[model samples]
Target: MILLQINQVARLFGAEVLFENMQLEIQSQSRIGLVGRNGAGKSTLLKIIAGIESPDKGTLTKTKNLSIGYLAQNSGLNSDTTVWNEMLDAFTAVRQMESRLRELETLISTQEIDSPEGQRVLKEYDQLQHTFVEQNGYSYENEIRSILHGFQFDATFYQQKVQDLSGGQRTRLALAKMLLQKPELLILDEPTNHLDIQTLAWLENYLQNYQGALLIVSHDRYFLDKVVTEIYEIARHKMMHYKGNYSRYLTLKEEQLALDWKAFEKQQGQINKLEDFVARNLARASTTKRAQSRRKQLEKMERMERPQGAEKSANILFKIDKPSGNVVLQLEDGEIGYDKHVLAKNITLDIRRKDAIALVGPNGIGKSTLLKSILKEIPLLKGTLHYGTNVSLGYYDQGQQKLQPQKTILKELWDEHPTTPEVEIRSVLGSFLFSGEDVEKTIGLLSGGEKARVALAKLAMNHENFLILDEPTNHLDIDSKEVLENALIDFEGTILFVSHDRYFINRIATKVIELSPEKSTLYLGDYDYYMEKKQEEAELLALLEQDQVKEKSVSAGKQSFQQTKEQQKIIRQLQRKIGQLEENLEQIEEEVSQLELQMTQPDNLNNHFALIELQTTIDEKTIQQETLYEEWEKASLELEQLDS
Candidate 1:
């Protein structure tokens, strides 16, 4: 079924037309990706479909009772409530039903058992219970917990107030709640903005099982390739649909453009031939009729418009004035971070000339801090970092913090190279997409992407032998990123950069360094190779944990057969404690099951107070069960030790 349809949609920004005559239909379970360059009105189109904005000229139709969940770029949840409570609020209907069910249960307990009022209450409760089960009331908390875990928001974070959360955390919370709401259509704009590689992987897995339709706007080509089955590209003030993932779309689009260009050129050749014949023969008396006929035919011919090629992307080239030593950089047991606290320690790295190394880690794991330490902008907490001979470093700060806000784009580059002529500086700036009056614009007035380009322009002028880039691809558009990637891939100088853009990393990185608080691990390959190794390591770790558990069990079994007589009393006590813990576990498990069943009933689902009470009870029981299991394990271990 078509969940939504947009016909002849037109949007205008003053006199500039963003898009026109756009038509789209979103069918049930469709996985559609919307891709376009920045300022192409992709987000605006999403807002229009989401009912957050109205199209200037268009008709939008939706299936009856269709629900859409839209998450705009960098959108954060605004709530004073605790994180857990905010998520719970997404299922207000379920909570309301739970409340009513509880109230019905209370009334049933008070009324005569054989009375019609009591019987009606019981029936109502049964109906509500069934509805609650269908709505997943019994497993909602577990679902929330699982999603929170996937987002790296643990149990401790659930108690944190949403108002106190960081912007990125709030954005994650918004996404989490939207997923919990389970709307028919989920529209996400740049959903991968703040995600680390691990969380991105988790989200991909989660969405693969999602039941609803998905419409995503993202610059992450890798993400789009994984999740989207169809692509809609907004270009040249028009929307073109392609039936496949991003990679397939690229191939199909290229072929289509090639065919279009060929047909256009062919038509142009025929038109020129007709025009030439008409011009020469029209003046001749013998050929006047033929000339007139040719002219008429030319006039009647349908002309094909020239096929529009890919838009121009910024040209980036990283060149070094001189070559550095083979050993470009060395870090010996280095510790990086603040003076008082070390973010990562025992790190050792040896970078060679012309090697492109990508540093990757989870958010807040100090990838940026390590970069700063390497640049010596900040004091290293410990150990030593040495630069090889003749290594002139050029740093690209992702935040563009080094750029002076008061300076114009032109001045920013010229000031760094006082001897360079103004024309030369302007030429370099123009290469980075700053042209004419754009050079006069103050750095403060520039957008993040503009600032990034300005920084690149400055870096280009430095003529450094080595480049240390921090989140270099953060604000770059897809095309710009690809250009930069290609530039770096071709550059002879060494590179050490931190980035979460897997596509860029894959394209440019020759080696990967995975950072953690404890240490850093090196993988001698690109991003994909690094990921494969990480997966293998994870599987091995899981197997090790399983082996440890089995070892403990085996130790217990052996000890049971070889117990000393003097240890008999202690073993008996341990066994008694274990039995008690097992009993408590069974009781808690039974109570949890019963509570879940009760939560599914109509009366319990409708009773708000009862629902809250039941949820609280379940939470307590779960905690208690976990505690008992730990105690039971400890007792069993102790019993085995005594026997041995």
Candidate 2:
């Protein structure tokens, strides 16, 4: 069943066409991922669907009475209502019906049973009651509470005034309200900004089972791949629909790009051959007729103009410097978190050179604080951290303080690279989405994404050996994020960044850090490895719970003091083992980097013996990394058996 259809949609801003002659249809079960460059009008399109804005041309028709729940990128709350009260307002219709039913009870008490007015009131009351029940009024509160609980929001925060809460908190409250609304069509823009990994996972699961259609405007590729089964690429002022997730879309898009590039080359080759024949033979009187014939053929040949892709999203290739040492950055009993609320415990982390570590946790787990701790901006409650000698550090915040608002694009980088020429400054800015007139714009005038790009461009000036980024992909469009992701993947530096964008993390992160506040468990694995470990942990916990239930019937206690104590001891031991394994893994990773450096050196190329030796060493390092993870996992199982 088609829920809504956008036909011949067109919008213009000052003679520049944002999107024209665009057509798209959203089905009842459709999960569409909207993609475009920064100024391509994705948000405007969403507004049109939500009835918040009108298109200059075309029609948007929906199935009759289709309810819509739109969570705008920045939806402000004016009413002084708490987060919990704000959510409960979605139940207003049922509440009104219930109130009316009570009023009718008063009327029925004063009227005769034989009177027509009393009978009419009684009928209306029954109708209202049925509608109330049909809407699941009985379990709605429980469902709302569960949704809020899933997001890691405590009960105390629920009653806090929305006006008093932070911007991120308001957005979370708005999301909860929308969930309670449960409209037929749900539209979300950049929904993962304030969400933690656990919350994001819960949202992914929620949308997977959602009965409503979803139209998401997000740069988080991980969210898109998990939630969307189809993609709508808004390019060149038109909507191009594709079947499958972002990964498949990437593959098909690359193939199309390659095919177009080849076709353009083939056409150019033919044009050149014809022009050559005409130029070389035109002066010969004997070949005059042939030359004239060739000229006519050239004139008659229908040419295909090459399509120019959006340059804003182009790849920014970089030359990464070599990894330097075995130790990147090591922490000893680090207690990192925000304020007095200690989110992370005794985090003895070791980030080695050439290691790409991604901080993975639910939102508000002080992932950013951990990065800040390493930066020395935030004090570690208890720990010692050391970075290897000659290691450089580059910081990229999603939209944090890096580029000054008053600073011009050229001035921002030129100040850092004083010895560098103006032409080099222009070149760096151009690669980062500021070119020509854009380079002249002050940093204050730039969009969030443009500002982020500028920050990255300036940071690139340092050529840092380690990057600490906090949600670097937040404001970046699909294209810019991809470019940044590719650059990080090829970067030869150690990276410890906090990101909820799983796709970006998966591309660059060789290791992950999962922070569990209540349990204070930190798991180290790559994106996929972390996921696998998570599932295993969940299953283990469930098994433990089942065992406890069995013990309740047999022993009439929650296991025993000795058994419980033993389990706790084993858990701590397992955590220590995992930490040790990570340390070993870092060492192995460093060796691999060293071997690669040796193999790539000019002196070693001619010496096959040395190259072969380095290759063997690299192979050994990989085996060691894998072996450590397997052993760590095995040891974890032994700890789980302590309570048995």
Q: Compute each candidate's TM-score over C-alphas.
A: 0.86, 0.77
Computed on alpha carbons, the lDDT of every model, listed in order, comes to 0.87, 0.78
- Candidate 2 — which pairs collide? 196-362, 196-363, 197-362, 328-352
Best by lDDT: 1
Model 2: lDDT to the true structure: 0.78
Writing each residue's lDDT as its tens digit, candidate 1 over 1-644 gives 89999999999989989999888989998999998888888999999999999999989999999999999999999999999999999889998987886687677768874689877876787678678768987567768878998999976688899999999999999999999999999999999989999999999899878999999998888888899999998998999999999999999999999999999999999999999999999999999999999999998998998898889888888888899999999999988888668788879899999899999999998898888888788888998889899999999998898999999998888888899999988888878888899999999988888999999988988889899999888877777888888888888899999988898888999999999887889999999999999889889878975564323222333445435443665765786788788888889879989988787677876664576577679868878876786687688778766644
lDDT of 2 at 177: 78
The residue-by-residue lDDT of candidate 2 on 1-644, one tens digit each, is: 99999999999998989898888898999999998788888999999999999999999999999999888887755559777788789898877766675676567668775689867765675566456556765446556767887767766677788899877777777887788888999999888878777788888899899888999988888888899998988888887888888888888777777888899899999999989999999999999789889899999999987956545464465544655587878887778766666877768677787788887766666778888888899898777888787777788876657677898888988988899999988988877767898888898988888788887887777777888888888788888887888888888778888887877877888888776553234456678888888899889878976564323222346678797666676666776786788788688767766765665576774444454455456557666766775696587667545533
Q: Mark the regions of model 2 whose C-alpha exceeds 4 Å error after superposition.
A: 104-118, 255-323, 337-341, 518-524, 549-644
